[model samples]
Target chain A: MYQDWIWGLVGGGLIGIAAALYLLVNGRILGASGILGGLVDGTERAHSKERLAFLAGLVLVPVSVVPFYSSVDTHLTPNLAVVIFAGLLVGVGTRLANGCTSGHGVCGISRLAPRGMVATVFYLLGGGASLLLFKHVLGVI
Target chain B: MRALFAFIAGGTFGTGLVVSGMTDTTKVQGWLDIFGDWDPTLAFVLGGAVVPMFFAWRYTDGRLPRLGGKFPAPPEPKLDHNLVLGSLIFGLGWGLAGLCPGPAIASLSYGGFGGGVFLIAMIAGMLAAPPARRWLDAVAGSS
Candidate 1:
């Protein structure tokens, strides 16, 4: 069930459809960080209701399916400090960059937008470098 | 209503994350670990998602949305400090935790305490971003 490449494609197809649906009906790019950041930073008050509605689905669907999937395992690190630090960095950094995997990686890149493409490059570089330093050189992660 | 659409869309996205095995942090980390044992599962996922969206973007050309809202403007191509620096920072975090916003939220439905803690810290970081961004823009002269 897990690690099946076929499932990955199916899932990815579903994600694409979701984004397409959001765009066609809601007329907007579907970016998770942007949606949540707006609510957190108070910059999206005008569409808070809409944002909440979207988030409600994002959060609830997973919860609802938990009973069926039994439980979801993320395999995140046990080191709380590392987790906190990483979370903080993700939160701040994504907001600064204006998108994440959903926005820049999936949506923006699909459109072949220069900005999303560039952003994707930097992020990949960053991820590669971080892994080298921590996972290899330092062996911390 | 548009909210209903958002809900459905969001739900579909969540379902995709669960079904695609994206919610699994190990696979995500594996993808990021290009130096070590790399997994190509996510690449397919990305490819599959992009194909449909590519058409979806084309569908939006010179058209109005059914829900009566403006499509998000294409991002400007001009590079800026925030875009580079922030993306780097995000990448660093992503490598460290392998949890981006989508999985982070989706995980909340049946995640462990560790995931919960990460979410809280992430929220705090988000709240601090505006001021931090202002500081960054000031330091960098707004690119």
Candidate 2:
């Protein structure tokens, strides 16, 4: 329905605003992967407190807001092996590349940075190819 | 105060992911499944997010740093094998699972067993990346 599109736009806009806020106030890029990565990888020790606080908010806000919004249907793949493989690829890939959708796609592209643009293009191409291979060639979904 | 702002920013970002249906694996997959029953909603979400962000970038240009913190240095524009290779690997995984880091974490509360599994695996993979990167670099250098 059109409502879904509207919500998507509004929600996306909010995400941009959040990124902007982080940039304006914190003077940092609002990259989900980098923030989380720094914590787990021991690379962001100096800013651990800030990272922890941001993650706490990221998790908590969603939990609180769930009561007001309709229950979200996640539709994650049911296969455990596939899920694990996918997770590993995403985790390793994002770190190796130094960004993900939020960091590279949204934040990177907005600034018109070449690295961000290049990453985004490659990932989308990769996603597209994977979809074709899995869905059409492999027929595994 | 810094933490508070970070918290607010994170909360807002999470809400946006949830509201935009970015947390839904099917929707994400749908966008990638362009040859199949493709859903256009994700495109709208991307478009909407980019508009304000575009302006944000422009505004920050040639301005003093705000909030008493140093602005991030512009990322080095070096094009390397790792960038392309990593992105390819990431894309394949994204298409397969339809859950990236942001939605994956945000959906944890509601995503049940599958979500837990994916998160644990992701963390493990992240922990492994440093060594992997080192090994990769070693191989590249040796060759």
i-RMS, every candidate?
A: 1.5, 1.2
The fraction of reference interface contacts (C-alpha pairs within 8 A across chains A and B) present in each candidate is 0.85, 0.80
Backbone clashes in each candidate structure, one number apiece? 0, 0
Candidate 1 docking classification: medium
lDDT value, candidate 2, whole model: 0.86
Q: Which stretches of candidate 1 lie over 4 Å from their true place?
A: A1-3, A65-68
- For candidate 2, the per-residue lDDT at A92 reads 90
Give the C-alpha miss distance for residue B63 in model 1, angstroms.
Answer: 1.1
Question: Which candidate's DockQ is highest?
Answer: 2
Q: C-alpha displacement of B57 in model 1, angstroms?
A: 0.6
lDDT tens digits, residues B92-143, model 2?
A: 9999999989888888778989998998888887888888889888988999
DockQ of 1: 0.76
Each model's TM-score, in the order given? 0.94, 0.95
Interface RMSD of 2: 1.2
